[model samples]
Target: MHQQAKLFSLTDKHEQDAILQALSHFVSLRSLADENFECTWHDTFDWRLFAAKQQLTSRPHHQGYVATLIEKGKKVEQASVSGIFPSFANRLPAVSLAEKVQKHTKNRALLPMLTLEGTVRRWEIVDESGQPALELQVLQLTAESARTEQHTSLNTLLQLLPLKKRSNDFSQNFFTIVNGLQSTKSLPVDGLFATGAAATGLVPGDYQPWQPSGLDPQVPATKAIKDMIDHCLSVMQRNQQGIEEMLDVEFLHDYRIALRRIRALMKNFAPWFGSGGQKLEGELQWLGRRTGLVRDMDVFLEKLDILQATLPKELQEKLMPVKVHLWQRRDRGYAMLRRLFSSHRYRNLTAILTDCRLPEQREGDAEPVSIGQAATDTIDTAWQRLRKKGRRLSSRSADRDIHALRIAVKKYRYLVEHLRNLFPREFANLKRFKKIQNSLGRFNDASVQAQALEEMTRRLARSNDPSLLGTFQAIGYIQASLHQQQDEYRQQFFQQWKQLAQHMKRA
Candidate 1:
């Protein structure tokens, strides 16, 4: 058996030193153990991955080719008849499996290289694109022969990769990051939710899918939706003063996120509100679209510098005033947003969110499970599944596993937060999980951002202000700070996971 975790970050030429330093720290930490570690760098058009694999020398390198040749999107499963099939006769089988099993599956064009959640897995590509794109996934696995951290520690560290999006723009794809850990058997929702939560910060939206419709009074999820709406309303009531102090743009964005979650919950589950739900969802949609002006301006400003850099020297000089004009327009839009939020119509909308209620569907015959327990079970089960597949996972397999685990942890976190009192024991652990998840997420975001920044730098090399160089410098500084923080948090999260496991054991 093997146990593993992963860390993701964006590529930056300026922050190259900092990133390498962080990787050095990770390597040093792993070096304390007797197991020899393998470090490799994978670069592609879309992403760059610096991976650390444990006990790679013990395993045989992959040699046999498996192809699910696709002609115009239709899969052809004949291995011998495939023109693209690589010669397997001269190469050795990289795996050791039951002889009977291997013999039975030999004729199958792509034999199962591994299995994850009963899904047959192989390293061969299902299809190929004309573009030069590569997706690299890494799993930090510890074999049975090597000394490894406990499962809790491993998971805590795993959580870091998804959250690193907060501090930087590089590693923003929470879904992709989670998918990379397919071997870890993480909860199905862990990766999905992690991605969603990360997206909420940048985009401020709802939890896309709202399942288990029509309501079951005894279902914890049904109650969770109700409780969450109530909590959002209560939060608004109590924090309205503080909320008013922040930029209306940010407050409204946050409010919209909560409202959408509420709307999605009601829409997904029971029609307890019947006509009222349609009304509420309509209002929520109105709020979301209205707030779009603010968010759009913000996103635009964030990219303005990049756009400026991409212009020609003459165009750059001419665009300086245009930039100021756009900035003024954005500022006016923000002011309008402030007034809109303060209006009677907006207040009424918010008031509805606070006052909305979910009546018990069947007179509440049985008690629903606490939100915390549901989160725990889901996350734990997902992690277990990811761990079981760790040893034999390929790049694609690891991506799917990690993504599923991230989703599991994310949904669980949302639930635990919804009913904090129900699972007091796990409350602290959930907090730790959130922290680590955010760390890894930022790292990944930074990776992508770095790529964007590099492209922009080239495009802007001949442009004005030379002060834009300061922007790149700022980017580098943020990149370094995020890298340092992520490295420390990864270590800390691993430790927290051990404590969380103990708490779970006692429970």
Candidate 2:
């Protein structure tokens, strides 16, 4: 694909004219066309397309609207159709692109983010020998908010489109000419879409979670813990809408991850959070349980096709009923989750978490604790606990025992990640912990899948479906396969745990 770059900082018309004049000194320039048009930018409610660095736009065409998908500032795909505003799944040219977008959007509907009516003044550039070189277009956009009817004119955008094959000589000449006219630096805004969104009084990445900055090792433990919780709460709030709307699976995934981190923070540093910590911990646990079923179903549905591919054709055909049952369960689970999010209890929980005050001290709270010291103590304790648990696990250990080891590893890994900035060298053990975590994680997944299949078999039998018999056999085969893989993973887990233990000791 050809490279197309947009410059959105060129606001001065005289400067633009000067740049074009400077370009004419090096190469032949011809004005192509100057026209005005309006286009609406569309994205899911959570801005999925924008998040993926893609833009979906629909503009008036000959007798209808032409929808195009622009990726990384280049028009990668387009389709012409007749509709006031057609769905992306219908207007996209390729099936794969449509499917990809549909998967990202899941059950959410697309909405227009902003509308831009702009005038484009275009010019064609060529070499002295009349060989086509590049196309330069200057666009002046007036963006209007679709929600509030607010209108604002954005900065003029200068776009460079290479007409023919680009070479080093051409690039050097192009930049040399432009660079000589003005000290052209990178644009402040990401692109036209971002500019339009900004002009409409919307921040493109405002909802993105931010990491803690300016942390000091000498900061008090209580202060550090509060900061961490506040950061996680921000992430949770940002993902709340996406999760409630079921815009995409990632929304729920990120929300769960952030929630998990918050729970871990409270558990590991309970003394720092003071007496109210226990109640908050309970509330977090309740929230986690509320969202668990939907996350589990999402995981199962994500791997359904891969699991189906493992079976023979006859067995695969019989697995259709299983897939259907899982999808139905997922839909129900999502609906339940939606209602829970909209509940008064959920709102109360968020309000409490957001406004809760940190305690000055408690009966067992640590006094004069430096953040660095607390982090080290926590990491050491978690590592020792994980090592103690892992040392007891073997191939002959019970499934629950191995699962316990997985949790320990997860806790230790989280500690290392959250406090890695404090101790860079010790945090290098993160790689070792990851190796052990992956092995145990895969084994745990197999165990869970086997149990879920068994439950599905029971449900099918109770329902008395005609395909129950074949489905049961297929489930049995899959469960057996999973058990075998779990056995192999169990062996790998022990070996990795041994290496990790040794690495931790040295560190």
Candidate 3:
């Protein structure tokens, strides 16, 4: 790769020429185009990776705040793969595409691009061993035209590629790196994030790092199996309503994820169970697919919403009646999902999972396989299926297949977490799957919300519920805004998918 923009000395503690000296090592700044743009690139991947300095600062009614800054850039392309960053250190904040945009807003030259911002979230995960990890979640929430002045203009040509595969490249590469760096270590309290947690002296248990230890063969298979079963049963029994809520809201999209991961562990690590493993594995997959129905429709509705939002306001208003009718139908779909899940068969499935039997071990066959090995195999299998499904869906342009692909990615991710002991390398790969999953997921959300809005509008036009009309108008704006994001990301998504396909082939 050609070297382009140089990394700069982000801290004044270094000196005036410090930025130049620091960046000069990794990049050559003395290139071209010194006139208009602050930075020029000879290479497509122009990102410079850096860890943030820990700074202590005063806050309201508090002594300090811990803050750390990661990668920073100039004139960066909005949706280009150049902006993607791997997961941050155990405790530090990770950078994402949207967060990168926000970081540059303080620069006057980059202000225009910043104003075109989208969604942003900070994700944190802690493991059993007291290790904490941080990840930044980003979504392109801005309008398409907002990016017109940028060096890259892929946003306008979104319709050129099939919608399903956009952003696959970024997702694939991201996961590859994440998996390599996967660790059960807890993030330290040394960075900018530590001050707040330290100030209260109330270290949150969830923020603790994960440390993997303790594997004993003397432990009985029944005991191990019971623990797994109890955990799932507890979740279902305690948060049974929450699980139902997820299904009702099509959150089964995620629940199926949780279910599938557990299933993979139970099936692949057969020694963990002594006998009856195959039967249980088959049943869990069935349940996963059963819940998948709600997930599929949810995605379908979201896509429909995106298509509808592209219409003129007048056309949208005219379609309001039809929108309401569709929602009632969607409700029926949800009802059907609930009925299936509530069946005796489904209950029996969970019961069996609770008491699953692993394959019997032969003489001298002590440990089946390490958790890390198991994780790698499980995720590898999942990734293969996702890619296959993604390809098939892309070729056929089938919405259901697209949804299935998302479901597969999610399930694989859950397995990645469950089997972290078996395979640390798969985390990065899981991250890649998540990126595309999220992109498609956002589209799915917009689609569902749009369907709801359209239906509400139709009902108001016919029955004239003032309250309903007000709700419809409110929802219409929300859906319209979501549509804007969907449209902007659509083009960027395809370019990413193309990249991912190429990368996967190379790998």
Candidate 4:
């Protein structure tokens, strides 16, 4: 479908009459559809088609059904197809639509959102050159119950489609007239699909990121903490297939973050987790090291192009050996990842995560801590620690000190973002951490990049590749640039830290 097609939502007979009356005075009006038409729309379980602003529908055809994929204004028909054929996107004539489906839904199957029975009347405008140059479709759709003879009305839309590029003038005039009506409102490409979903009580794109569900602060520590980890596990499960198949770099990145979140939560709430925290941390450390290497490689590979672009054109090609080495290492990391994921130990990675209880009857440990109480105490402790670390740093602070401060800021950030819902409104001002995190993050990245450059040079020196000298020069130039960035970033952090410190004292 051509997204250039204009869709205006209409309300009732008054608006329809007004549009028709206006059209008659300007041009000939015709009802292209003299009868009702029915369509069944299909979308992925998460509403991927709707999210992509596309629709796949099977409407009545001659003696059988045909599937038409509708995007902006372009339509492709698969003849003699019946029922909902959404999952087989490759069968569609258009490669773009198939790729879009694959991208949005990944491997998910498409199911029917709803069926619509409606009437569409189209008006065609003929150009002065004796050509039909523009068209308008007045759409009225409804969802009908097959057994009850009942129907639910959907939005009525004025759809204007240009028949040719030469039809711009008429299209403009028609849109102007439609715009004159107070009742008509314009909509986007997914407008029609949304209206149908609304009428049928369907919601799309209902997927989770990495946030925990809302918890009452008074809830038991067991359920609250376990529930948070379970949510992380679910996200990890969702992205594992994508990572294994090398669908994109983001899959492993997300998987690693999920894993890290679990580790952070466990490490932060160690007392509640008891002595097994050590064993759990070690297991996650092994897994984290594996995923971290790949993730770091991914980060560098992404920045490699931007860094290389800074070099003279002649020197740009010289870094090809470094790029290849990173790619090979990244691929091998994923191979290790796949093997780990398939192992029995991977299946039982969370086996020790079970039956964790708050510590028992030692002086202050008798009563189990409430989720609310624990969250408040944890964030306060992290805040104090962050302030203590920041106060110890100076303009001459070592890179390790800066890295330590960054870790402090991150630990506090994670708790504030995740545990704020468990505390009061005082901790709800999330914007406070933005400036601090951004500056700290940039400084850390530049530090890591410089360190990685020196390490890369050492590793490549041992490889004895003939291009060693050029690679060394390229690494040297890049390292100098990175070190400069690190200096600027370090100063920027001091400024951000001062501003945050004053703000906190005032708060």
User: Mind giving the per-residue lDDT tens digits that candidate 3 earns over 256-310?
Assistant: 5446557655654555555566677777767766665556555555555665676
Candidate 4 lDDT over 91-171, as tens digits, reads 544566566556666645555567777788877877667677667788877875322234588767777777888668766
TM-score of predicted structure 1: 0.33
Question: Which candidate number would show the highest lDDT if scored against the true structure?
Answer: 2
lDDT score of residue 70 within candidate 4: 73
Residue 495 CA displacement from its true place in model 4, Å: 1.9
Residue range with the least summed lDDT across 10 consecutive positions in model 4: 354-363
Task: Compute the lDDT for candidate 2.
Answer: 0.74
Q: What is the TM-score of each candidate against the true structure?
A: 0.33, 0.77, 0.41, 0.64
Q: Provide the lowest-lDDT 10-residue window in model 2.
A: 180-189
| Between candidates 1 and 4, the TM-score winner | 4
| Residues 1-507 of candidate 2: C-alpha lDDT, one tens digit per residue | 443453545746557777677667777788897988698887775667777887778899888877777776667677776656654364455576567666666644667778989899988877656777777788888998764467998776776667765543674567555644553444532466667776778765455443444569898777777787788888887777767767567678778878878887876777766777788888888999878778877787766778788988888888888889888988898888889888998899888777776655435555667788778878777767777887787679999999888877776676666787886776776787788888987898788788888888887788877747778878887888888989899999888877767766775
Which candidate number would show the highest TM-score if scored against the true structure? 2
Q: Which regions of candidate 4 deviate over 4 angstroms?
A: 1-203, 354-366, 424-429, 462-468
lDDT of 4: 0.73
lDDT of each: 0.40, 0.74, 0.43, 0.73
Candidate 3, poorest ten consecutive residues by summed lDDT: 153-162
